[model samples]
Target: MDNLTHSLVGALLGQAGLKRKTGLAMPTLIIAANIPDIDAIAVLLGGDEHLALRRGITHGPIAMVLLPLLLWGIMLWYDRWQTKRGARPEKRLPVDAKWLLMLAYIGCLSHPLFDWFNSYGIRLLEPFSSQWFYGDTIFIIDIWLWCALIAGVWLSLRGERRGQPSWRVPAITSMAAIILYIFANGLITGRAEQLTGRAVQSQFGIVPAMVVANPVPVQFWKREMLWRDSNHYGQGVFSAPDQVVLDPKIGQHEMSNTFALAELSKDKNAKAFLFWSRMPVLREELREESKVRILSDQRFGNPLVQDRFRVVVPTEQDAK
Candidate 1:
């Protein structure tokens, strides 16, 4: 999920009654919600280093515990500072250490839960185990979710301003609706994967080793399916009973030589990409007498969008 969604979720959680528990509760939730993303600093290192680190340690089990504690302490210090300066708002509830810590934990945990819904995947057990997990239920940027969250927050604010009773109801309802929406998408993804897997086997006469059904933005019932077999890879758009195979190609041809590609995987960038990629494919090109191999993850690799994480390696002869 994008940072906006994360922030909105945090704000909604605060509106859903958590704000009454302590001073600066809303800021604690909003900030903690986006805290794990501090790992994004890896992007400054350039290359695919960010890809290798994005959802790793900062989102792992160890950091999950420590990060919230840090946020809790910071929020408490800020509250004390405001009090010392005589700038604390009269309407602001007194800060409670226990409630602040609890909100911090809730906000921090929400980050990974939302991230798990997208195809980008997350390393929940990183450091301990760098395994990636995917929910395949929502697109990275979901307009519907944005609307739901925004509307809920807007309505809640309006109610509060109007001095209406039960101002928190809208936020609570929105959170429940979002959960149901996610559940529905999960069911759709599972069914679409099953249909795509069966259709691929029927059309290609080969069982797919893995199949992923990624949600299409704005099209709730539609999914983009990618499947792989030992020798070939296939992609298609699936809508319930119908499956359209857009591209089916021999997977072996993706690489010029299996041995060369395997050897190239030893590179640090290549190793990181392989570890992170869920549906990897390769393309080889010849420049002069050298072999240029480009490895990509098929999940996000399309003709129009060449934004897939790629690791280019030239053979030793070409390096010369």
Candidate 2:
């Protein structure tokens, strides 16, 4: 999920009445919600390092425990510092250490849950297992979710300002709606994968080793399904009861040369990319009499975005 969505979730939690628990509760929630993303600094290392480290240890169990504690300490110190300087607001509620810690944990936990809803995947058990987990239920940046959350927070805040009896109703309703939407999308993804898998087996006579239903923008009912068998990769369009239309550009380009792939893995970028790529496809290009091995993940391997997620290796001979 994007940072704005994460921030909105924290705001929604606050508006849903968690704000009354302690001083600076809203800020604590918002900050804690984005704490796990501290691993985003991995981008500075360049190449595919971000993919290797982005959602790893910072989103795992160990960081889950330590991060909230760290945020709790910082919030406690902030409150004390403000009071010591005599700059604390008089109407501010007393800071409750227990409540602050609880809010921190709640906000931090929400980060990984929302992240898992997208097809990009996350390492829930990072340092301990290094396994990737995917939900494939929603797009990375969902406009619908943003609109609902924003409306809820705005309405709730307005009602509160007007001293309405049920000021939190809007936020609560929005949260409920978001939950239902995610559940419905999950059902859609599962059904799409099932239908596409069956169609792939029946039409192509190949049992896919993995099938993913990737959510697209705007049209939530539709999915761009990508499937891969041991030898080939293919895609299809899936909608509702019986719409599974396979694309005609399916190819047996997974990896014909295991030796070449192994040799290329010696490079740092290729290794990191392979470590992160769920469905990698390799193809060769001829340029200036040199064989350029282009490796990319099937999800974002299209021509337009290939450069963004690709690693090129120079090979003396063409890979067979």
Candidate 3:
């Protein structure tokens, strides 16, 4: 999920009454919600290094424990610093160390949960386990979620400004609605994957090794299905009301030679990209005497968006 969504979720949680638990609760929640993304700095390393480090250690169980504690200590120190300078807000509620720590945990835990809702995937256990997990239920950036969170926070804030007794109602209701929406989308993804799997088996006489039902923007009922078998992989559309249409342009792997793959895998960039790619495909091109092999993850590797999510390895001889 995007940082805005994470921030909005934090605001919604605060508006839903978590803000009352401690001084600076809202900021703590908002910052904690986006803390794990500190790993985003890995992009500075260039190439596929970002993929190798992203959503890994910083989002793992170890960070989950340490990050909140760090945030709690910082917030406590900040509060005391403000008091010493006589700049603390007079209207602010007294800070409760316990509640502040609890809110930090709540906010930080929400980060990985929301991140796992997309097909991009996340490594929950990280150092303990490098395995990637995907929800494939929501798009990375979802307008619908944004609208709900924004509306909820707005309404709740309005109620509070007007001194209404039920100021938190809107935020709580919005949270419930978002939860239901996520659950429904999960069901949709499950059904789409199951139907696509059966259809692929029937049409191609091969059971797919993996089937991903990726949700698209705006049209939440529709999914872009990417299915892979031992020998081939293809894309298709799965629309609601029982419609499944598979594209005819099936893709095959051209890098079948063991020695060639070993050589290409020797490239750190290639290794990292392959480690992160869920649906990998390869294309070989000749440049003078050397062969340039470009490996791509089918999910984001269409011609329109080719440069990203890809790795290029140059070889002197052609792949056998």
Better of 1 and 2 by TM-score: 2
**What TM-score should be assigned to candidate 1?**
0.94
Candidate 3 lDDT score relative to the true structure: 0.91
What would the per-residue lDDT of candidate 3 be over residues 10-84, giving only the tens digit for each residue? 999999999998899999999999999999999999888689899999999999999999999999999999999
- Candidate 3 RMSD to the correct structure: 1.9
Provide the overall lDDT of each model, using Cα atoms, as 2-decimal numbers.
Answer: 0.85, 0.91, 0.91
Backbone clashes, candidate 2:
0
For candidate 1, the per-residue lDDT at 261 reads: 62
lDDT of 2 by residue, 134-185 (tens): 9999999999999999999999999999999899999999999999999999
Error of 1 at 143 (Å): 0.7
RMSD of 2: 2.0
